[model samples]
Target chain A: MLKEVTAATFENEVLQSDKPVLVDFNADWCGPCQMLKPTLDKLAEELDNVKVVSVNIDNEDEIAYKYNVSSIPCLVMFEGGAEVRRSVGLKPRPELIKFING
Target chain B: MYDIIIIGAGPAGMTAAIYARRASKSVLVLEALTYGGQIINTPDIENYPVAAHISGFEFATKVYEQAEALGAEFVFEKAVGITDSGTCKKVKTTENEYECKAVIIATGSANRKLGIEGEDGLVGRGVSYCATCDGAFYRGKTVAVAGGGNTALEDALYLADLAEKVYIVHRRDSFRGDETTVNTLKQRSNVEFVYNSNVTKLIADKRLTAIEVTDKLTGETREIPVDGLFVAIGRVPENRGFAQLITLDDAGYISAGEDCLTNVPGIFAAGDGRTKDVRQLVTAASDGAVAATAAVRFVASLE
Candidate 1:
């Protein structure tokens, strides 16, 4: 299972992590976000050098605002405490894997 | 190898699976996105027969479960191309290839874009296609929704409850949706209807702040400052990938009749992407049933 980030642990677990972090900004009621959960779960198991986590934008509004996320199912890739890439909406697993690996 | 392979998982495709599996035919469904197609973006389906006020997601989940329970397999992968070998057809995807005796194409339509200036670059910045997913960010802010159809009307209604102000821009003078919904939207105190205008430009530096719309009849241009822009301007056929192998009309929809028979013998087309006059959710389910019935007959005659 991908780690669910809280405001308390977000800084040490994400911003200061040794590996690149893939953050999923999502909410409970979003349909596309639910559709994408299984894919992210499988991806969290496959990648060795990347850390995957989910942030409930409904609960963690501050983190979502800081990341400038305006949409559900938003994926942001962070490397060295800086955002490297970001994409909005639902994407197939292959496209998502490419988004992270690239 | 499967007896039949359906290329979508929406109302049309899932309904097709329901019919095909009832005929005791082995079936596989391939979908690029999650099931439910464009209808998933809809909040609720108002006119479905026998189902009283069902949300789009609930209806989709029920249909998907029914199909799954009856032994139809579903995979979350896009069918890229089809290779026909008379009796047997091969479907290629980004992940793997599969073999089937018959194929049903129920691929639905994608969201129709405004294609305005700077619209492509503003997707994450301030422009969005789904109002329910992104509307929370624009709370207490001003937003605009483009189009005059049912989806546009619904988007405006959803936004009006959240945003401090909502503007609905349409090229036509009146909405094409139901009269009841139009009346309901007009009742909202913060909602403003901008009729006979088309959104032509997006004004943004890093994120969207304003939009420019041109009056279709008068040629007058007006700028509206908005925190977010939602697009719900109907849909276009998603048949470009199958254009080389199937016959298509001038408008890029698959040229299939009510019987769902395409130019190819073993290939059938169904749903909104097919050449049909009435593109409704019920009509898509009707197409699915017709296409699957035809596919079952074709596969039986093959042996």
Candidate 2:
């Protein structure tokens, strides 16, 4: 299961994590986000070196506002307690890997 | 002569350039406007196969970069005309003329405007032609879609998926779209059908606020508040200049033969500008590949 994080816990849970963290900033009503959830979960399960968490924009306003989340289904990657890469929406599994490896 | 001179840097043109470049052919793409063409204004492309989902701008940008990576040269110039010299073709842009062994016309099409007041000024702001491009921006907001055609229905359905409510304002009493689509839209609780209504004015300054719809039956003018208005009336192919050089259909679209051959030798047409049954991006890309392949074969025959 992808760890559910709130605005209060996002920084500590995702940004300050020891392992590489993939934070999914999305909303429940978004169809594309729903389509992307399974893929994200699968990636988390397969890749043990990475930690995956989800943040609901509707519930977590501070983190969303900080990231300037204009659109939903945004995926931000953090490695060793720092922001590394961020993607706006759902990307192909292979493309996501390329982003991680790059 | 240069191997190929592909007109327009749209998806069709860019794809052709990529293929021709990979085949070691010298490819030059003449573009009037930006790289993406009509697809640039589009927000997202969900129906495009293999991509799953991506913004049309992003997808077109990826194609542009990929074509560039394969060594395709791009020039930003509006093509005025093309003259065939039997063995070679001379493509005349606004600034200069280019001589090439073969040419591919991929000028594509443009969105047909509503022609109502404030329509032109509010294009990207509130009045939009592409729902996939602007739908996400109108999330939880209300929007209106004009026209009753297939494109209009699809746009309304797509917008309904994102927007809180989608009002389909059509001039006719019934939609001319597919029955399944009409049924599906009618089933959607958020979609409202405003029949026999035509948009008289698009009122907005910084962004779209509301639209004045005039009822054809009662001549009643009603103002509906909405954040966005999607116009899906139709498209006009950009083939005015090329019409004098090639055989064009009644609608000013290019008339291409079975092998994507234009009336003029060494000249071919592809994508929405060409005479084809389908005008989807997949088919457009396929047309580009086919046209480039045919042009390559035609060039090889010269030797």
Candidate 3:
């Protein structure tokens, strides 16, 4: 299951977590966000050492602003509380897996 | 070796899978992004025959399901390279590589971005290439759409119903879209046309706030306070990955004719990625059918 993270809980859930976290910065109004739901869900289920979380830009604008997330369906990989990589737009499952592993 | 491998999952690629499966050829489809391609950005599709007014997502999903039911296997992977061996072809993707007797390049096109200042930085904040994907975010607010093509007109029309006001900024005095679409947009009270003008700058800080429009003939510039800017200029073919394996036109589209036959003997090109006169849903489907038939014939010759 994909966990929903807010600005208040972002530090504990994503930044300070032991496992690498994949943060999906998305909004309800974005169509690509809707399209990316299944791929993220699958990634969350398949990966053991990674935590997948979602932050709605509409609700958690501060977190979005902090990460400089200007686009919907922005996938940010956080390792040791620092952003290691970021990808914009909808990517397929295989590419998502490759991205997370890399 | 697999009988055929198609590198894309859009309408053309999916249609090729259907035809290849019907021909009793083992088929594999690899897609880089989510299925549906640019059509997913379209809110409504009216031109596809028999489907008068279906959402682009629904249309693409139905076609995908049809292909799936026909026993064609699909994998979500981006093809990074293609190599033609003496008797077979090798396709390298982000995840894995596959060998096949025949290959079909059906990768479609991506939306063209407005290379204006701040356009890249403000992509998600307020600037978007797909109006249907981001239009709801700017509901009841003012927005501007650039270009004079069918996509631009469609974006303006779609935004008119959602936004308080929409400005269609076109470099040409007239639109290149269908007359009926232009007429429909002109009827909307919320739609405004900025003809013979270009978007010179994008004004934004945290997000998009406004845009600068310059009149080409008058040399007058005006700033429109818009919450979002939808760029619909055109699309560029997604053909860079396989450039080494096939010949490309000046515009980067694969050099293919109506038969979907590329310069490579066993490799075929189809859909919007190929050089064609008309890039439409119907034409894409037609290309898929032709390419699959040609691929099946090539495989038979090898046998």
| Candidate 1 chain B, poorest ten consecutive residues by summed lDDT | B36-45
Residue B82 shift from truth in candidate 1, angstroms: 3.4
lDDT of all the models against the reference? Answer: 0.90, 0.82, 0.87
Residue B109's lDDT in candidate 3: 89
Query: Model 1 has how many clashing residue pairs?
Result: 0
Q: Which parts of model 1 have CA positions greater than 4 angstroms off? A: B42-69, B83-85, B94-97, B277-282
lDDT-better candidate, 1 vs 2: 1
All predictions: root-mean-square deviation over Cα? Answer: 2.7, 9.9, 4.2
Backbone clash numbers for all candidates listed: 0, 3, 2
Expressed as tens digits, the lDDT of each residue in B59-109 for candidate 1 is 888899999999999999988989899898999877899999999999888
Candidate 2: segments with Cα more than 4 A from true spot: A1-102, B39-58, B205-207, B217-220
The full ranking of all candidates by DockQ, starting with the best, is: 1, 3, 2
- C-alpha lDDT (0 to 100) for residue A12 of candidate 1: 90
Q: Using Cα atoms with residue i matched to residue i, what is each candidate's TM-score against the true structure?
A: 0.89, 0.69, 0.81
lDDT of 1: 0.90
